[model samples]
Target: MDKNTIIGILLIGAVIIGFSIYNQPSEEQIKAQQELLAKQEADKKKAVEQQKAAQKKQEEIKKQTLEDTTALFHQALTGSAENIVLKNDKLELTINSKGGTVTKAVIKDYKSLDGAKDVTLFDEKDQSLSFKIDGKEQNINTEELFFSASEKTDSTVTLTATAGAGKTLTMRYLLGKDYMLHFSLQAQGMEGVFSSKTNAVNVEWNERCRQQEKGFTFENRYATLTYKEKDGGTDYLSETSEKIDERISETLDWIAFKNQFFSAMMIAKNDFAPNASLTSIPQQKESGYLKEYKARVETFFDPTGKTPTELEFFFGPNDFRLLQAMEKESKFGKDLKMERLVYLGWPLFRIINRWFTLYVFDWLTNLGLNMGIVLILITLLLKAITYPLVKKSYMSSAKMRVLKPKLDEATKQYDKPEDQMQKQQAMMQMYAQYGVSPLSGCLPMVIQMPIWIAMFNFVPNAIQLRGESFLWIEDLSTYDPIAEWGTNIWMIGDHLSLTCILFCGANLLYSWMTMRQQRDQMVGAQAQQMKMMQWMMFLMPLMFFFIFNDYSAGLNFYYFVSLFFSAAIMWALRKTTNDEKLLKALEARYQENKNNPKKVGGLAARLEAMQKQQQEMQRKREELERKRKGV
Candidate 1:
């Protein structure tokens, strides 16, 4: 072997020896590894045994739980349910033995939207209510259990659920002569049957509200789930396809499933717990229902049966004046604010109706005139009160109309775009000379807008107009179908309304007259803008015909009558106005303005400042152009 090969072999052997020494395990490490493997095997076996034992324990617990729940309430769980009737002057209630629930409610001597049948506010298929008892052995579900009912009186009943060892839960109901039903629940010989940790019981209320009116769209828009929180303002679920409210962090005094014209309200004297949930789900139009409303709430419970939970159920029409009188006469309803269920509108319009229109309407109704005549009188009264403002607005427009010749001559003088600033300046000067304020015409109309919108909210919600008919109208609260095809169509609905057509016709005539008066005043770009506005205004009445076809006859009648009165007033003012005399007065005022320039003030002053600024800017632009061209 060569010398280099021999050295390389020795080096390789030494490196292998060093690596073996570095990685070699000690006796202590080998012992520890074996112990670890043994411990792992032992742990695996212990886990398998524990899992099997836990499963067996769970099975035993479930069997015991079943026995605890079902053994005592055997009779209560197996029987068929029976129903009993409770009648009064204003309401009839059907009580079921199964859940101790009010299965149905009918309003006495009242007709629903159909105008033919007595109003059935709710039936067994539409609503159900139940209580879940929190007990010691098990959380008892009372909904599926039966109770033995006893007749206490003509308007009162007692339903009792008895278990083994003579323990019992009893529910009692008393129907008042009015629309309210008093309810209470108590326990007897059930000392150890309730859990100590739970202080309240759960209440389940589910309602698929039935359609109460022919106009589903109108009825659904006004219906919602309304509630009043203790020491807080009244609130409600949003009117939409689906909504849920689970954030009620305060005790509540009452909750209501409010329909458009009626409601089924539950008022708790002791108040409900802070934890509650409310849900709203809309139903299909073909289902003959408005929406589905559900509420899961909690109420205070007494384990010892010392005091019973007390509540009152109100079933009646949403009459504003009646509810107001009831509130004044109630012991617990002082703070209830139940009349809010009859919505007026948002704050501004509501104020108008609440403070003015309601009082006038009630007075007119008390006068014993026909409803149609009452509406006409109200329209005439409103027109008379607002005559001064209307006269001033028309006179302003007429002043501009009389100056058309002077305006046309100025238009010819400043026809080019470059003279636009001069034209505006000249127009402002002419308006000042004629002593006219353009916005004077609009401010008065603006002041009258709240009244118009307030009436729109008032007419539909007026319960007094429900069945009152006049002049071939069967019901004023719903649409009067002068022409109905018995088929649903987009935008036009299933009917053509007579009042709606009349209102649109009056509106079109008014629009044409107003446009003719204003068109002569506009020139240049403003004239083009006026033409576009004219088209929009003319189209509005046509669109309103389609939109308002399904609206209540009362609302359409109000609009039609109001428009007819307005057009007549305008014609009267125009006939009384003398254009020649008005023009001579304006000429004299112009000569006076020429002599006394000190009359420049108010909006005219502002316009003068703006006109000067425009002229200065135009002069500077011209000078700049000249400089750029080296002029």
Candidate 2:
């Protein structure tokens, strides 16, 4: 039995034993367990309170650390041996010989579109902000900020921010308002420079790529994302950049720039230098986002007699409508369109996912008797639509199976790798005579990848399945629900996911059946191909087990159903095909045609010639070796 099969059996055994124990739980057992827990809690409460008080004191001490950071800023900005704070907001930032440039810069309350209205100090929605020191007061300008609103749109919200000097930077939450929150940063000051840093932002995503790593990198015309957070575990992602966007001018416009998902950066012409590459700058891990960004920007421009260079900022979700209205790379909204499988196989898959989900899903959701079934119906419909392709693949596999014996004989005759070329030439002639194309089966399977990806993305965030339950599963929208175990463990969660287990079993069965059929036909390079496939059979299911563990149970259920259907189809094919008769017929035909004196030889004649050549080569090579050794 395969390792997976053994593991599967063990898992089943464990579940059965656990179930039996759970059902037989006695009142005395429950009472004893409860008493032990109550005593432990009673003994720990006093020490826990004391520890809590100590933690509170430590938190206060940590809060004071922010002021020390603020002091460092003052010392650098003053350009004085002894740093003196002119006022509370003005702090000196030290950048080495180049003068410590802005370490970080961002607008906090202007964090999201909802928070944009609170950014009142800036005028246009895409407004540019820059600060400079003129004697005692800081010279600030929002003209380059480019704050804007639609000609007449009710989704309008008020934006306010502290400006001038000694003003508290504050923004209030706005209710029942719609606005595009836009933010851009100034990090060119750090470019052509090296430092360790981190950047954090609060952003929400409806659907995200699961495989992206924390340090994922993308480079293109507009900007370069040196790295991105793989698992968006934390609220924000930080990146380091070698180049920065040079266009710091104040002309409000949107253009293509490179981003993690799309290609482009949305910005105005006057806010940054022309042709200057835009890049994400990192900050210290311990630094506060809003406070650090402000301090860094202040420090960035301290050199040119405190010349203030304007900066633009955006804060909001990549809603297509909002992105388009903002005119800052509106394509960020393109995400609302299903796009993962746009280029491969058939573009129709993308169109279907984008259109069907938007139009049909919501309407059909009302009739839901467990969204898992709805998902299955959707998959079945898709399969029906693409039935021709899948049928072609099955037929090809059947044809390959019929030709397996002839292919195997060809390999046996040409045992040496160096003789493979001649062996292939002969094998090709046989295939040509039989009118079989070796690639026919693989082509259709390759074509199905895109449709698979489109479905993978579609199922997870499909709101229809959120609270729905299927048989034995409580929630199709989340993972298969199971009560936790008493023994605590880390990383891996306590409850076992039944859907994931079923999904794996189905995958194993499908893989085993497919592999068994291919094993007989494997030859030379194809044998190596079979080995790789076996590895995939083992690895792929385990990969899905971890990945789908947290995904919608409905998605896993869909996969299980698909695999089961495939297994059934394979069984039907095997039962109907007369393999024994087919093999006998092929062998009889080969024997009858072995010495027909045909030109260029057939598969059987080629095998005879190869075997004779193999014997002669072996004899000659052995004789030559003996002579050289003076034997």
- lDDT per residue for candidate 2 within 1-631, as digits (tens), equals 4566679879999999999988985999889989999998986897789999966864554445334554212222222221111111111111111111111112222222223322222211212223322222222222112221112222212222222233212111111122222332222232112222222111111111111111111111112221111111111112343232222222222222122222212222232222222233433322211101111112123221123222222332222333345443332332211122111113566575666643455555657545766777766766677667766666656766888777778657776767776666566656544445556666545755666676765665343453466788766656664655654344344556788889888988887887887775666666666865697687777777766655567778888887777688667767877777755665565555554435334443455466667767877999999999999
Error (Å) of candidate 2 at residue 84 is 39
TM-score of 1: 0.83
Model 1: per-residue lDDT, tens digit, 406-508? 8778776888878878888888777877787766657545856787799888998888887889798777888888888877899998888888898899989
Give TM-scores for every candidate, taking all chains together and pairing residue i with residue i.
0.83, 0.45
Residue 174's lDDT within candidate 1 is 88
Model 1: residue 48 alpha-carbon error in angstroms: 33
Clashing pairs in 1: none
Q: What's the lDDT for candidate 1? A: 0.82
lDDT of 2 at 619: 75
